[model samples]
Target: MSYQLTHPSLQHDRRILLSITKWLLIVGVSQAVQIRLSASERKRLRKIARGHRSPVREKLRAQIVGDAARGLPNTVIAHRCGVVEDTVRKWRGRFAADRLEGLKDLPRSGRPPSFTPVQVVEVKALACQIPADADVPLARWSCPELARHVVAAGVVESISTSTLRRWLTADAIKPWQYRSWIFPRDPDFAAKAGRVLDLYAGIWEGESLGVDEYVISSDEKTSIQARCRCHPSLPPGTARMMRINHDYERGGVLAYLAAYDIEGARVFGRCEPSTGIEPFMALVEQVMTQEPYVSAKRVFWVVDNGSSHRGKKAIERLTKRFSNAVMVHTPVHASWLNQIEIYFSVVQRKVVTPNDFTDLAEVEDRLLTFENRYNATARPFRWKFTRNDLDDLLTRIDRHQAAEPALTEAA
Candidate 1:
């Protein structure tokens, strides 16, 4: 038998058997660990196992738990996965028993809502109801009023002012600020609203031209100093501090509104000696005539609901002359929609504030300078209120009107 040498094939077979036995031993021993999980724990394990593995440690554990075949040592895995060794061991044992479903996350612990969803909805409805039978004097709602009314509805134990605020913030409700609009009872409201929407919508959809008015953005500002008190008094070569009367009743600063739109690029303002309708109309006409043939498809004006603008004859004249021109009126008591308001605020802060004017002319000059500086880079206003807003407003107003009974026949 060739000197009794061991057979090579038998040796190889023994080595293979040993390797197989080693893996079988590891698998059998690993699977023997038993960790019984309650329903909640099973759910929690499943949740932790979701999604792709991240480079981070917990993500790797999730990845391992996600797959039933992959196995890591309890201690090494726990450290790598940012979980305690006990948790890793427990999860690994349960996962072996239940497969991939064992990694679910358990539901959170918290108090149930005070009000059911249906009751919450009813509460919101009651809170939105107008205070007066008619939407007058009390146009919009205050949080305190809304909370009081909601409490009266008996939906909740009690609604606190702070509670109402939390609801508003969480639910994204803003009832305090006034919105720009009115329910035009005119049967032609839909048509008129459509027309208005068309003009603004085109500014983005197709083309747009800037529209606005210059009323003497003028307002009376009091406490303008007649003399400079900060500088030392001196002769012609010396500096002198001017003196101004502190009496506001005697005199105050009068600022004007001179506004301009330059090729949808610059907004110019001037403070005129007057803010009369005549000057306003004159400036509007100037804006209309001065515009270059500049490929302007249309001009849309965003003006406040000032009486001067609605002057029937003047409006008719302007509308008839410019077929594509559309005038949009900011709702009564809703001046925030007008971008000019923002510009005017800026002007007040930067150009006209923290100083006293000796005369209206000085004030006007400052305003004019500001306008010139701004108009150098004027741009058309991009309004966002769409047809949807108009529709909702109309529907609400219509509902209010429809719900009201016709005036009872006078006896």
Candidate 2:
């Protein structure tokens, strides 16, 4: 009996079978006549397979060269190794032509040296010394000035200011005045810092207030002179140059101790002839007793590591009087950690910079007015870099590994 070619499932099976058969035929023929390896290719394969070391690189070289020498084409080797065929061909050609030296990287060409290592050290030492010791005319030694000094000292043969800057950057040598910083290595540093952060973070959210004292964030502008507004006096025929004798004495310079409360969003400032512990304590008392009560059930004060602040008798006396008074001191040289410094910066920009009043009372009045305005709209500060950030950063390096080799530094 003859079978009919009309069954749908049988037709589908026949088409799939034809495709498989065609693919198998092409593979079988292609494998039969692969490319042959040249003599140069065999030498590279032998050397990489035997003498040259570095397990990872050796494995790569061996697989590419050995596969080619075994009569497989570059394309076939690349496909097997999961890389571009051109990469395999390029490696093969280079290894054959130039041997080991060709595989090594070439030195990048650039301008020659202007300063030696010894000379750079001498420059650094000179820069680090006091201006008096250097016998220089300038008050301080800036980078450019230091570069000139190096040339003048006959340390470096000849160098440009730009080249000196480049070397400094490359060497990571910073000569600018830096505040000496010291961290509290106490076991409870993390816990104490966290407590301070938590208190400030949730100051407005709950019943807690932040108390802090800010000294003059700037020096007193003592030499401010008050004079009449400058204008040419008009004659009878011309219009009048309307002017008045500006009040100079009534509004002179005033020194102030600024105390701010985080929850109340208000500042209480006291003007004194100078900033001393007595005025500071008095201001603290006024902040505690006179100001209107904020939402906080208690107040916490955050201060920095200053000598006047660390007076044991004063702190003990204040703490005894106020049941809720707690003082948190930031790590030495870490005053930026305090949020009140940020408030002081704002005061400098808005209140102090615009106009120099003729007398001290004007300075005092301006400070008080600015404090009033700030308190009316101030909001609680949000601090996010928790103790965890610092903890993680400090412990990142693995102690178990051998220390890495020091780099050969350039002048």
Candidate 3:
């Protein structure tokens, strides 16, 4: 029997076949959207994908492109890389459109800066100056105070302290903090300080020191008080810190004299009721009477300008007592350069801090015991600062001083 062309059953069947074909074409096109990288592109992508230091986003993009180039389907690429299917598809399409440049983040639009550049410069300049120079009563500039002052001075119409703080933080400027420093007032600072630095480096008079010659850094830690706590100290336990009593009884005070061998890492310390010419002389005797030092070709004693050992008279005395001992004094107010001060700081932190001694005798015993303990493992300090560093520092200081006149004139 011949079928009619306009039959309802045939027409319905035709519509169904057309719809199936359309859906199949769509699926084929979607799956055919694949990435094909060139030789150079492939090398770059592989390098980025394998790099441990590549940026996270760049690495992800590179990995996506790499997998896509390997004929991975979008779903498989997403699954393997722990990313969403949409993300994989998006990056794949972007690479196909613009190659590697399309993987970078586009410039974002955010809020404009609240303060103008001029206002920022003014604020920073004020921060660089002392509060006294500005005739303000504040000793230093807090963020809030600085903001208010800038507004009052018409630098900015208005500003928030938090915003000001953010600006200062970006430039690493903190005006509210103070660091203690002193200028080199002694005229012979360079000559004297250079000599000490040279000694630490095993150099003297432009020649390497002899093997038998020794360098010693000596200093006195005075007024160490013994504090007997009213309540017993609590030892640390699970999830608790060691408790030390705030109230303490003053047992007594004493002075500690220590001498450190800059080259050998040896320490000799003595506890005395007080520090003076007499006590310091005894410490010298204790060290000078020992081996190696006793028969050494030369022993350079680096000391600070303390009253106990100061001036030509003290040098004369030390040299007269031990002919091999050469007294070398650090520049005035420059005790921080002394290596013995470093040992004293260690003693303060480890032995004297949070002091809970029962009596003066306990304090002395602890200090002496720690000296021996330190010497057992002690090594010479790695003194890196040399004459070159000193010269550079002084040059910078001179330049800063020379600029003051111009800065004042401009103001």
Candidate 4:
């Protein structure tokens, strides 16, 4: 036993000696590696280390460099920063070699892109065009369908739908979605739209409208149905939604003709079995025969091209019937410019959407009653879109049209 030195305490002492030797070797290696920074570099490192907004990795690198600059050993820096000694050593070496730039990750190696720039352009161009234009049966491009079409057209040999989707996402391009739009086909679209916008601004032919003059936007809400629910509508309760019966009995349909005073914030409306010259004229009489309008200097009526009031004949008929009334027709397909449409949309939401009336009479009552309540509190819509905005919009459309041929040729 004496010869083998078999005491347990002696064995433990030997293990302690080995551990101490290993630590000494590591400390010696770390001490031998020194990092020095220039004055500007030291200042930058200090700022980055103390900055609250600096990225975590950048802050850590800055701390390592700052500690190294102060001649702290790598082990001490690692302990202070709660990182491995190797991490401290690596960044220290990087800073000493390439300064700040070396702290950033190097360019990574990967497979080259599957699609070339021309192929990408082709795909995006196809996405913008309608499917019919491209002679495809589909209405719109699905990502997979687009990928197949690209391959079939020899734009590329093969491509993944996911890869194409990723590329499209990066460029904010989506071929699968669409919004309805119409070109202002009316050659006189600019002139006509400008007059309406000006009237809203209280100007007429470069002159401010007189206080006695009134502007009215008139339109018809057609085929409003009265649907009697098979069951009564359930009122909303705690943690429960208001339930409405999807199935209902047909209670009949009615048309609502309404005139909205653009400046006066008044509404005149009536229910009719159908919309035609006679019914529309009744609404006109309802508004024009009233006290202020009856004696006003001018009553400008803005209307759209419907069978009830279409073209020059309708204009002559309205002006002749009431000498003080002037009919202004909005461009075809441009009812959005009328303020009265806004009021009708509100009525549809508040009065007619649920469609729970027992008969058409109830529908009429609710609409008329709501109109009175609305007029009591309604203010003139703050219509800010002006002739200048209309001009800018037209200019953009012209530029887009001018560019279309080039895009088509390229495609």
Best-matching candidate per TM-score: 3
Give the lowest summed-lDDT range of ten residues in model 3. 25-34
**Range of the 10 consecutive residues with the lowest summed lDDT in candidate 4:** 1-10
Which tens-of-lDDT digit does each residue in 1-411 have in candidate 1?
462226887778888999999998788557645444457754654565554543344445454454323344555566666667677766676566665464444468789777678866765665565556433347676888777666665667786788677777777777777555544545655665555455445443344534432111211222333232244333343465544434332234454544423225455343444455565565555555664422244556556556556545645655776654546554454454455666667766886654555555666667677777776655655566677887887788777777665533321
Once fitted onto the true fold, the runs of candidate 3 whose alpha carbons sit more than 4 angstroms away are 1-32, 35-92, 97-104, 406-411
When summed lDDT is taken over every stretch of 10 residues in candidate 2, the lowest stretch is 213-222
Ranking by lDDT: 3, 4, 2, 1
Better of 1 and 4 by lDDT: 4
lDDT of 4: 0.90
Query: Could you give candidate 4's per-residue lDDT for residues 1-411 as a string of tens digits?
Result: 363447888888889999999999787866655777788888888888889998999999998888887878877899999999889989988877898998888898878876689888888888877888878899889999999988888888999989889879988988888888999988899989988998999889999999999999999999999999999999999999889998999989999999999988999999999999999999999998898999999999999989999988998899889999999988978999999999989998899987899999999999999999999999999888888899899999999999999988997
Ranking by TM-score: 3, 4, 1, 2
The local distance difference test score of each candidate is: 0.55, 0.60, 0.92, 0.90
Q: Give each model a TM-score.
A: 0.49, 0.43, 0.79, 0.71
Residue pairs that clash (backbone atoms under 3 angstroms), model 3: none
lDDT of 2 by residue, 231-349 (tens): 33233445655334343233434456666565555666767776555666676677667534322345666766555465466567557766556566655555666766777678677
Candidate 3 all-Cα RMSD: 6.2
